[model samples]
Target: MSVMELLASRRTYRRFEQKAVPQDVVEDIIEALRLSSCGANRQAVRLVVVNRPEDVARVQPLVKWAAYLPPEQGTPKADELPTLYVAVMQDTSIPGDLATDTGIALANMTLAAWAKGVGSCIMGAINKPALTRLLGIEEPQKLAFMVAFGYPAHKAGIVPLTEQTGVKYYLDEHRDYCVPKRSREEIARYL
Candidate 1:
């Protein structure tokens, strides 16, 4: 699919089909992230892959929505269990620009996952101190994202909004229960 189509199709898939993504495919996604632009060529980003049941189980202790997310229209039920997880991080050795550099690489990986027809949800609601220990990340290294990947279990459809809706939160609208977005004008700004 074209870049526009891919961007339009990207969704935060939490629920997933119980199928394993190929190891090579997973590697390719990480490779794409690796090739993405890095701030000052700091190349501080580190991607940790989790596919095995044991590995995924370990992450549950680290992830939970920071708070109850609002109900969204036409949003699909994310698979509580994802077969794969990618943890994006940055090396501490890089000085003065960890956050910005890591963010760019994280965005690249997110888009790359979408381009592959794999759905992902980026999580920031993590216990940093615990995660750092859980993932064996050392000083100067930080976990920036916990990305979940899988085939969607629901058929996401266009989600509408009202003029009064200030935040662009999605919801389950279609009867089939897939999560799709509405037109760009409803969410984008030209300026």
Candidate 2:
């Protein structure tokens, strides 16, 4: 796909089909991240791959989601839960939080996974201390982000709405999906 097509196709895929992501594919994505543009070409990012449902269950409690989306339609079966997790970390030696930089890396993986018929969910707002303990990460550096990956259990598509439009994607009382976009003319400004 073209660059624009790829960008438009990307989405945060939280649901997953019942399958395991090949180790090599996960490795390749991480390899791509290693070559991503860092602050000073410092590849201080670390990724921990988790592929066990038991581990996912253990770690799931520590991860949180934005309130924007309703609770998931349904949870995957014990074995069907996403089995791959990429833990994005910032090195202590670095003098920065690396959140944005790491997000870029996660974004790369998210898009790349979608391209390869995989799905992913970028996670934040979770319990950091608990995740640190669960992942056995002892470095006092930083925890930039975490993402879960696997075959998608749901359809992959876009819900387009720019900031100029007041339309928003929100959940209804019945836990249904809705999108309300604001007209561009209403919010656009001429300087």
Candidate 3:
């Protein structure tokens, strides 16, 4: 698919089909991230791809999902959990705030993953201290965020928003997901 189409269709996927993502595919995604725009060209980000069942399982509990949804609806069902995780880390050795760098790398990886029919959820609500220990990452390397990847199990649709309706993602009565986004006219002002 073209980049525009991919951007329009790519959604934050939390519920995933029970299937393993190939290691090479993960490698390709990381490779794309490696070449992504880095703040100051610091190249401080490091990604640890976890595809092994045991490691994926270990990483799952460290992540918290869907803050807008209730506990029951927010958490992925047992069979719907992602099979792979790309743990994005910041190498403090490079020296600088990594927010922009991390965002660029994640955007690249998520887009690349979606192009391959893989869906992802970039999670910031993580148990960082615990995850660092579990992953055996020490000083100078900090877990920034994680991107969960797998085939989507549920449908996510983008819906137009109104002033009265705040833009928060929610599940419809049928459990289908909807994300409300502001119109371009509301967000962009041409000179």
Candidate 4:
């Protein structure tokens, strides 16, 4: 698929099939992170790959799911959990834009995953302290985000934003994700 097509189809995926992601795909995701550009090339971002089923299960509860919808509709069932989790962290000892670096790395990783037919969700609303402890993250390293990945079980797509639709993403009647996006004309201006 073309890059634009890939970008358009790479929506945030919450519900996933229980099938495991291939090891090569997981490695590619990590490699994407490793090669992602960072401010000043500090490359302060660190990662912890939770590909083992048991370890993935341990990390699941510590990370929250979609916030726009109620838990019943947004959270995945036990059988629908992601097969992999990659914890994004920042090395405190290396000073840089943590947020920007993490964002770049995540975009690269997720895009790479999607290109390989894997779905992903970048999670932020999580039990950070507990996760840090559970993942054995130490000083000089701080957990920033968790990315869940697997084969998607549901579909998600962009919907035009209307007066009634506001901006929050919602589950359609079919339970597929409907993310409302403002038109380019509404958000951009030509110089």
Would you estimate the TM-scores of all the predictions?
Answer: 0.79, 0.78, 0.95, 0.98
- Kindly report which residue pairs in candidate 2 clash with one another: 16-153, 17-152, 17-153, 165-182, 166-182, 167-180, 167-181, 167-182, 168-180
Alpha-carbon deviation at 182 in model 4, angstroms: 0.9
Q: Write the per-residue lDDT of candidate 2 for residues 1-191, one digit (tens) a residue.
A: 87688775565555566777987778778876876776766667788877776787787767765456534543344554676887788887766447667877877777777677777778877788888888888765567678888886555443446664345455445533344545557669788
> After superposition, which runs of candidate 4 have C-alpha atoms over 4 Å from their true positions?
none
TM-score, predicted candidate 1 vs. hidden true structure: 0.79
lDDT of each: 0.68, 0.69, 0.88, 0.94
Residue 56 local lDDT, model 1: 79
- What's the lDDT for residue 184 in model 3? 95
- As for TM-score, the candidate ahead, 2 or 4, is 4
How many clashing residue pairs are found in candidate 4? 0
Best by TM-score: 4
Model 1 Cα lDDT, one tens digit per residue, 1-191: 88877766776665678777677669777877778776667677788888897887777667754133433322223444677888888777776577777677766777776676677777887777877787787766777778777776655444554564433444344423333345678669898
Ranked candidates (TM-score, high to low)? 4, 3, 1, 2
